[model samples]
Target chain A: MNQVIETLLQHRSIRRFTDQSLDREQVETIVKSAQAASTSSFIQAYSIIGVTDQEKKDKLAELAGNQAYVAANGHFFVFCADLHRHKIVGDLESADVEDSIESTEKFMVALIDAALAAQNSAIAAESMGLGICYIGGIRNDLEAVKEVLKTPEHVIPLFGMAVGYPDQETDLKPRLPLEHIYMENEYQQDQSLFKKQLQDYNKTTSEYYEERTGGKRADTWTGQMAKMLGRKSRLYMKEFVENQKLNKK
Target chain B: MNQVIETLLQHRSIRRFTDQSLDREQVETIVKSAQAASTSSFIQAYSIIGVTDQEKKDKLAELAGNQAYVAANGHFFVFCADLHRHKIVGDLESADVEDSIESTEKFMVALIDAALAAQNSAIAAESMGLGICYIGGIRNDLEAVKEVLKTPEHVIPLFGMAVGYPDQETDLKPRLPLEHIYMENEYQQDQSLFKKQLQDYNKTTSEYYEERTGGKRADTWTGQMAKMLGRKSRLYMKEFVENQKLNKK
Candidate 1:
């Protein structure tokens, strides 16, 4: 009902952006807003890299599935699920924390921490009248991202975000109904209810694609998900996380 | 600069709550605002379980490292990183999606999706003059949670949230300096810069604890991290992820 809630509820991902650049103060405030988000145990296990150089942005754009918005946006940031700082903190305290930091739970902590901060950044940017899109496509090639960003081990680039003045507005994408997404205190194994919800949702999605893509591609939600999930996507992410030496004792 | 950004920047985790309960309409509005957050590829791989029953809340409180707030908050929600709906969606389309749904990337997608939604929910709660605290302590024992919540396979209880009108106001926890957390174009392997920033921050944190605890406990950020990360915490999380049949081909 308030402006903040209104800003959040009217959210949309913007991929295309005008050529206007974000001032330093705006980016600083945005990152500050991100820092204010909740972090597990106050660990604050995340880092963000602002990519402004055109050459580097081009390389990053290519690495992230050629998302031109990575370079074209007013600002681009790669949010890193980082524990390397903890390592330094341990070293400063003369404690060996490599094994403890490498646990899968710790890794999940960092990953979730990065995501919470990013969502705050996204909302903050939007509140400032900026358009933004998340580029999970960065995972399309993690090795290149590591190299391009010189990201050290114990630090993984989870995703990138592009922010700028809007070049276009997009129709809000439909989501699964609230009943389907919100359960009671216990998980409801309602196969019939779930099936019924998706059938109607798929119909809405089919029309959404038909309208958006000019009938070139009109498929149900299940149809699209099946096509996507039928084959292996991002199969290398396990190896990527493993290579970070996170899943070790 | 704006009210929304100001609200975000001033956020603090509220663990103590007054004996106030959220109205049904408020809960409905909060969940609706959560549903408005961005999802990856429209999968919306997340679910919110509202827990208002005191018995279940007490059990969840015990399970989540005895965080009394889990039971005392105005409203509690267990945010699940769920792919179970996608499974139903698959069955509706009669598409084999097990392999695709179980990949590490998809798992991360779900995890990030849940966090984004939870953050939105937190902001929405705050905008309505509510208070919130995230309970990652839920991961302290996921099996108990799954049993309590009847969570099925492919659905992980990612985290919980306690929302209420604040019973107590706590100081905002300090974060690492922007220079330490933000890099330009590439990851900065500047150990010297990180050390400098952390030393100052550690001093600030030590004073904060000293002041907060009436001089009973005075520890630096590095000191806390060293003590916490010196041993394996949540050692069973790897097996938990493994048990979900994710992160495998």
Candidate 2:
């Protein structure tokens, strides 16, 4: 593998940062890379918010379940799935696009566009020896987040990325085996085989946690998924999405 | 900019490819890079399907509106948002994750996960001097795609990617100006300024199209967006997603 592949493979979320911060040059590189990601049907339906204000960052941190890194990173950027620009375009061009813009298809396009750009930015930062972490905790309260960010309708703050010099290093977390995740032409849906693969993955995950936490925690992947998924989470997402005038169709 | 960032910024979709096929080693490296992307809450809620059967590829190409690249690429990959494994885990572990697995939040997580991984794989392919294009055309008929691929419930085929050597070169498409897409601490919702920026972008886009198509086509970004959004396309997407047992909460 080349340096680019190596950079991608070595990625890990950095929660703690040093005093050093990212300069405007680094930010430019990252965002430029983001813009270059392919958009569906050439619809550039996304935006980035650079949060330099300490007050706003602190509010965001509290709103993201008190993730300190959200406020303390070298630079924090919020990636938003935006269709308000398209709405303006429709009005300016005298085109009737209300139905399309409100359709779930457009919503998916925005979400995918935002995600592709954010991933590119993350890789760009990693290549430059900077550490970055995506802050999904912002979704904890989208209403308050919208209020704090002063965003208008048709723009959802999907996630945030905190970039900086790392003060802590994390081991690479094990992923599902390639057999389980990668299919050959057809999806291998045999229940017995799938169960066995997950069972094997459970051992790997439990050992990973055990090693990471020095036996303080020995958790299996399924056990963790069960606990996290059994309980409700972010149930307000659909309602919030609709109220924001997005994905209403 | 570094080589990695340069690879990203210099990206353009390649519609045609040479006969050279991606060997297993290259596929391994690319998939490994993809597996390293950060997943939401470590759910790893995504999967990759490699289609090598010519019959399946031809069917996909036809299903994807006869995009020849879909059938003629060095390699084809389908990135799927998978919650089936999570459900299986729930069953195996006897965990009550039914509601959570079907939640919009989990659906978003799976989509984001797949997108992040696909972008990484794209970059990895580009770094190796291969041209890759994301085929959103697959969404035109998700049912047929699932039939050809034999995927089970709780798995949505989000997008297809065609990777191969470049048979043709294209110019970098101009994106929205940084001023328009990038904001300060809060969203710049000022419609007047936004409109002006978009108008400026319109000129850039028109000039680009004119230069590319020998002045036969001078399409403004807003014009294209207006025209595309004015039509009702993919009206079956929401229902298809629901029937696929994804995001049905």
Candidate 3:
């Protein structure tokens, strides 16, 4: 395998970082690489806000479910699904953008754009021998996050990312078998087959957690899913989307 | 810069593909790299359906706005934002997953997860000296796409990707200036600054289209935006989401 594929397959989410800061040029290259990702119709409906201020980082870390890595990383960036730039482009040209910007399809496009770019950034950071983690906890307090980042309407803070030298090593987490996630021509509703696979995966995951947490958190993947998806959390996302006026009729 | 960064920076969408098919090992390696991508809370809310059947590919190409590449590529994979597997997991455990699976946050998570994995897959394919392109036109007819793939409810067909050897070469598309896409700390409403930069970019883009299309299509970025975003298109996405019973209250 080539270096790129090796780097990709060896990926691990690093939550702790070393004290050394990233060089400005390294951060710039990361952003440049992110900008190179593909976009729908080349609209480029996303933006990255790098957070270097200690105070802001601390507040952000607190708002993002108290993730210390957000504050401790050599660099942090909040990727925003933005249509504000499109609005500006439309305004400058006196073109009608209201219909498109408010449509659900446009919203999905922006989300996909931000995500593709973020993945590119992650890969680029890893290629440079930097550890990185994506912070989805930013959605825990969307309103507070908006205020913290001073993000305006037509934009939503999709996710935050922390990049730096690794302070701790982590094992590559196991995933479901290829057959479970891949299908041939049509979707398969093999309930028995999948349930059997899940039971096995659950046992493997239980052992992983047992070893990782020193027997403190020993639960199967199903157990973890029950705890997380048992009840609705982050329900405020609907309100946030409504507040953005993106729910086109 | 390294080969990885150079490959990322040189990314170009390849629509025309040679008749060379991918080896079985190469396809498996690409999927393995995709599974290595980080998932939100480790939910792994995604699935890939590799469509190598010509009859199925032709149907999908027709559904995806008749994009010839969809049928002509050496391989095609429909990356689905899937929650069906989670729902099945919940069913097996008898967990209260109804609320969570139907929420907007969960929907966003699945979409982001699928996009991240798709990007990793794209990068891995490129590393193997293969070309790929994302097909957002999948959304143009989601119901037909769902039927084509036999995808179940709680699983949305987010996007499709075509991968293969390059039959035609294309230039690296230009993007806006760094200052326009990258902000520091807070959101910037620099309308005047961005407008000036966009005007310059539009000129470059106009020339690109003029030279590439043999003067058949010559327009600025703003001109393209006006034509695309000036009217409401793909509004059925909301209906599609609702049809999946994901419109949580």
- Each candidate's lDDT (Cα)? 0.88, 0.91, 0.89
Q: For candidate 1, lDDT tens digit of each residue in A57-161?
A: 999888877878998999999999999888887778899898778887888888889999999999999999999999888989998889989998889899999
How far does residue A29 in candidate 1 sit from its true spot (Å)?
0.9
Residue pairs in candidate 2 whose N, alpha carbon or C atoms collide under 3 angstroms: none
lDDT of 2 at B31: 89
* Candidate 2 RMSD computed on C-alpha atoms after optimal superposition onto the true structure: 0.9
Error of 2 at B46 (Å): 0.9
Q: List the residue pairs that clash in candidate 1.
A: none
**Fnat for every candidate:** 0.86, 0.80, 0.77
User: In model 2, what is the error at residue A140, expressed in angstroms?
Assistant: 0.6
Q: For each candidate, give its TM-score against the true structure.
A: 0.97, 0.99, 0.97
CAPRI tier for the interface of model 1: high
RMSD value for candidate 1: 1.4
Q: Which runs in model 1 stand beyond 4 Å of their true positions?
A: A213-217
